[model samples]
Target: MSHPVILFEGVGKKFRRSLKADLLYGFQDASRSLFRRKPLEHLRSDEFWALRDISFTAGAGECIGIIGPNGAGKSTLLKLVNGDYRPDRGRIAMRGRIKSLIRLGTGLQPMLTGRENIYIQCAQLGLDKRATDATLDEIVAFAGLEKTLDAPVRHYSDGMYARLEFSIATCLPTDILLVDEVLAVGDIAFQIRCLERLDSLKCNGTTVLFVSHSEMTIRHVADHCLLLFDGEALAFGETDKVFLKYYQSIGYLDRQLKPLGTSPEIPADFAGVASIRALAVKGQENAGGVKVFTGQPVDFEVSYFASVPVDSAGLVLQFWNQADILIATTHSDTDGHRLSLKPDGGRLRLALPFLSLIPGIYRVAGGFVSAGDWLGYGGHLLTLVVAQKQGQAYEGLISIEAKVSNAE
Candidate 1:
């Protein structure tokens, strides 16, 4: 069998906290090398490991997502892979040519025009004048910077600069690509274009290392994922399992249900009006939360207590992803379904024929509204774990049923 495109064996990288310590260590290491003495293998007093014992491999046409919180060495790992930094320990092997979309405008000269900078970047990528000329129009069109092509890069906005940089970097394909959160730079349309470009490159057998905090984006692109925490590889494997571990690590899955009306979104007038006592999924044994496969039936039974009689109270269920982004909302009033709750309390069941949510963890919050006035709100009342159906793959926040057929 052919070799993997990229491989890492017990890789580690360290850095000093202060410039003084860095300079001192650099001098010491230089002297050790000159004298042929053994270099230090452990962390010094003022130094710490930015990454440690990171071992993984990427075969051709695979995209490995690197995810973690801030200061988790996600960027550091990409820099190492891009040859911008040398590891203090272990080994990294890479085959064929490499290209990176890490720090988009790093090599750009402020005094140079956008048109001139394109040629410079092409040269840096080892493209000759003829080759650069041939692809120049394509790059300019991709960037959508035709009007500003002759303007100095210093006059360009941050978004314009990023567009130019991304266009130039991705104009050509390479064997391995390292992407580090650069997709979030431009506008939404540009970001979509970038993702399409990445997909095209991957289809052409490019091994990719994609680093992003957006789990949805990671899920959409990566076949495997590497999660880092405090410079250590916490978990590395399939995207679903790794994300589950990530949620568990951050206490997202273990979060206890808070009392109704305790959420900050609950209005002051909503106090003592009505509160959701419990939210459970029908037919689920686990009272803690709900777990179901994509396209599976889901029934959310929300038990609530009302202090006063409400003739027409509507129930609203909001679904938010792990990033606290609201993905979907189902309100009873939207479908002409309103509740007639007694003074004491009652149970409200919101049944769904099919749950079309993509595979991931979601926070389910319930609220009551009557006559356009907020009754009460409950935040994080329940957790919804949507898993992929057996032998099925879906992307984005929701899945839609469709039939495929060939044109006659």
Candidate 2:
């Protein structure tokens, strides 16, 4: 791809669990080097591979998103690229100048005023007085810290520190950028500005390596993605494909729905009146669970038993996201549809011509009510996993159809 701006071949990094082992290994490695002995290639006791055999390439103007669970070596990879840590094995090649927003207040002097720290950081980034002076106002404005620009950085809050750091780092143009979840500290408005700044950088032919846990953000910004699991590269390719693989690797297919809360028991007065037996995706059944893609036709079948005929009954289906927040719900009577259960039990199917849910895990629940009183409630009866539709650009918890047109 036109001479990659960054390349990593078989890169591996290790760390000792304790200070004692670190010192011991440091001395042993130094001794081996002094005696012209080969360096240790295998891990020793109390040592573990933080990253192993990671290889990827990034060309100019491309943003590669690194994602996985915590301790997946995402930050480690960014540090290696930023030269904060050197790989013990393999090689990392880079072209052009690089800037890192890897940590909050990383290069700032806490004892110095924000105004002074700005100059110092700019100098470190290879900007002279005239250059830093030209962009100083812009940076201050972007950080929204003009009133407190003369205050010591130690007095600043986490959000203030993040805003200032991000503004300074991205104020000047560079060939490569490394961001590691630092934008999360800023407010949503600032985060949006940072995304715009990243877009501008990409337009200037900058190669970016971004690490974050928010899949929606990653999907919005990244051209490609790298998935890490337990210090290894599980998948790396197109963002959508990698995300799908990531969900699968994390047991999303086999993940069980957690109970929303204490499920309401059948009231003594209404015992055996009606009960929800099962809730499942009509046509998508597998050993792991139910899975479907975005925009695909879906049918949810709710199985129930009615001990006695119920003249008036209402059925409700709920969809909850991973955070247990209710996203969407449906009721049989909402559209003037009556749900009358006969003495015999049967299954009711709710059909959707096109599912509008975005790709993620969701919990399906069913409830039965008669005349505004709940007869039975079943929560988290089924775990529904929605996958990204190939070549679809929609994101967030749900997808909606919209069109953009020019104003008359």
Candidate 3:
């Protein structure tokens, strides 16, 4: 009979905004827990909830993906499961040996050689010398670090280090595997290999907890998903339903575009030389409040007010998908385009010959930098809807022009 390999019941984790307050409150919570008293559920001064009333269960062979924007408690939940942090209130039950690849170079020593580090990591996971010897060659080959295995880990590049870390963590199968944002490492081929390895693990009945910013990857492997927001479990269940809820929360699937009245709250340091007054997109037949079709000539304009005349100012346009993944960026500096801003205000125009994006909603971000300093920046300031073209059925996020010829 199948059973749940991991379970969390009414889990709630709290933290404090100030370091001193965190220490003080942590002691208080510990004392209360020791005395069998209920911890305070309401917010106090200088305190915040990282995870609140989160409950979920993953049965054997089921893979659960955790996702949210930054600081949404995705990593905190994984840490609780890995025993790095304990919940303030609630219980987490695990039924087997757990392996975690939460961060790069976590269980590795800088001075230790790659070969030595592999043995050390395995030993830390309760593997003996016999088991380590059995998997050493395979691990080295999978990481493609044969020449550098004997070299100190400090000498390896980030890609090499990630490869070795991922290889070692997944080399031996365990009952539960926890991976967090480590799949973005290495080259494209290596990432595919890592995904294949995860699929293999799932086939072998390993309960997995996966976390990544890539929605496509998560949707590919996860049997279920959890969407966390503002320290609360906003949605949990099937993969598609949870993903839809997640995107909806971020206004990705909204039929009507939001009013572009004010820009997103920029960081304090990002306000100095210029202010982004407005953002507008113009297509061939559209005046510009959201919907545009593929193959249309789109002109994206950023209107800004300059406090002082600057000659070395540069503008940037970043395009992000519905999943909040930055797919492309265009920079004035990269294209050798120079901007000479006047004192009062000016509009900078970026004209696209043809918008090659497929049928989907995308978020546009605008940024202004002067003298190598970011003067103003705002993300998701404008939304665009790229409708499908009349005669094309493109298969990817964007369309590419290519010619096919036969050699006879």
Candidate 4:
């Protein structure tokens, strides 16, 4: 058997608490905190253990995904491997030259142009200027920033910066790579290219440590899996089984989505906004919410928070067949309010009066926006079962409620 490329043994990280310690004292006591021995001392109480005793291993050519809910320490775990932070206790072992996409432009020079930054970055990674020059065009072309490569990086857009940084960081033939959800940086073509590159690299002997909340990407790319929760290892093993367990725990499938062995998944929930943490479909347990029936007054609710308030927020919830086509979008909220929601943390709540959805495990998808940016995402919120028998007629989608007489 081959040796593991990355091994995490009892890895853990602790962060000093933030300034909320003095909150214990009432608002009136805020004045006393100014003279306190150490203002940061107050922050000590907010101390959080970001990652707990985590243990895992990945061999050459293997990609392992780290997943969990927000604040689950998924990011911290990757940072630990990337050498961003020192674990208060425990050790991590690596087998190859590790390239971390933890930060964009790790060695970027503020006053440098994108061209200079690229060369400097290459040199720092141990490449000669000649080697840097050779690969420079490929990087620029891949980033689709040929026009801006000579311009100052200060003028680069966030996506452009991501592309440049990613192209630079990944250009080296490192034996191992640590990646975040950096694929969200470029357009779809670039994204596909990057994924293909990762696959190509993996086939050649590089190990990948991927961090994402995307279960599908993980299931698609990882050979082994690690589930993190509250900064601790919750599960780790073969990707298929472990990810399946994760899906079940997250309510993706209940004992196999009822109808038979198909795990529920949300491929594109927010098709327009900046994306969301996650989403699910549920109803009152006692209300027989187990499986939804067609023509039933079922409820569809999408919940998501923004990293920053976008200008607009909306969704295109499309129910797809197994082949994946837009059967229909049951709801649309484009009243001009979703794009300009006030308050950064505001969420949109949309309710459909009567659900005229056809059953057969229809997948739901739509766009969500806050202040006007779209989150390119997808997936199934829930698999509803439309009852074959027409129980009680609803006064909506099926038809408007206006009586018709023979005379009419």
TM-score of each: 0.62, 0.63, 0.62, 0.55
Each candidate: what lDDT?
A: 0.80, 0.81, 0.77, 0.62
Off by over 4 Å in 1: 257-408
Per-residue lDDT over 1-408 for candidate 1, one digit per residue giving the tens place of the 0 to 100 score: 169899888898988989999999999999998999876876677887788777888999899999888988899999998999998889999999988878867869999999899999999999999999999999999889999999999999878887898889888888988888877767888877888888888998989999998887899899999877667665677899778767754546534423332223433324458878878888663332355767877887888999999888888888776655566778889889778888888888889877877666678886788887678877778877665533465554577877799999
lDDT of 4: 0.62
Worst 10 residues of 3 by lDDT: 257-266
lDDT tens digits, residue span 29-101, model 3: 8899899998775667886668866778998888999987888889999899999998877889899988888
Clashes of each: 0, 0, 0, 47
Q: Model 2: per-residue lDDT, tens digit, 291-388?
A: 67677788888788888888888887777665555667778888877788877689988887778776555677767888887777777678776655
Model 3 misplaced regions, further than 4 Å: 255-408
Q: Rank the candidates by lDDT, best first.
A: 2, 1, 3, 4
Off by over 4 Å in 4: 19-46, 105-107, 254-408
Better-scoring candidate (lDDT), 1 or 2: 2
Against the true structure, candidate 3 reaches a TM-score of 0.62
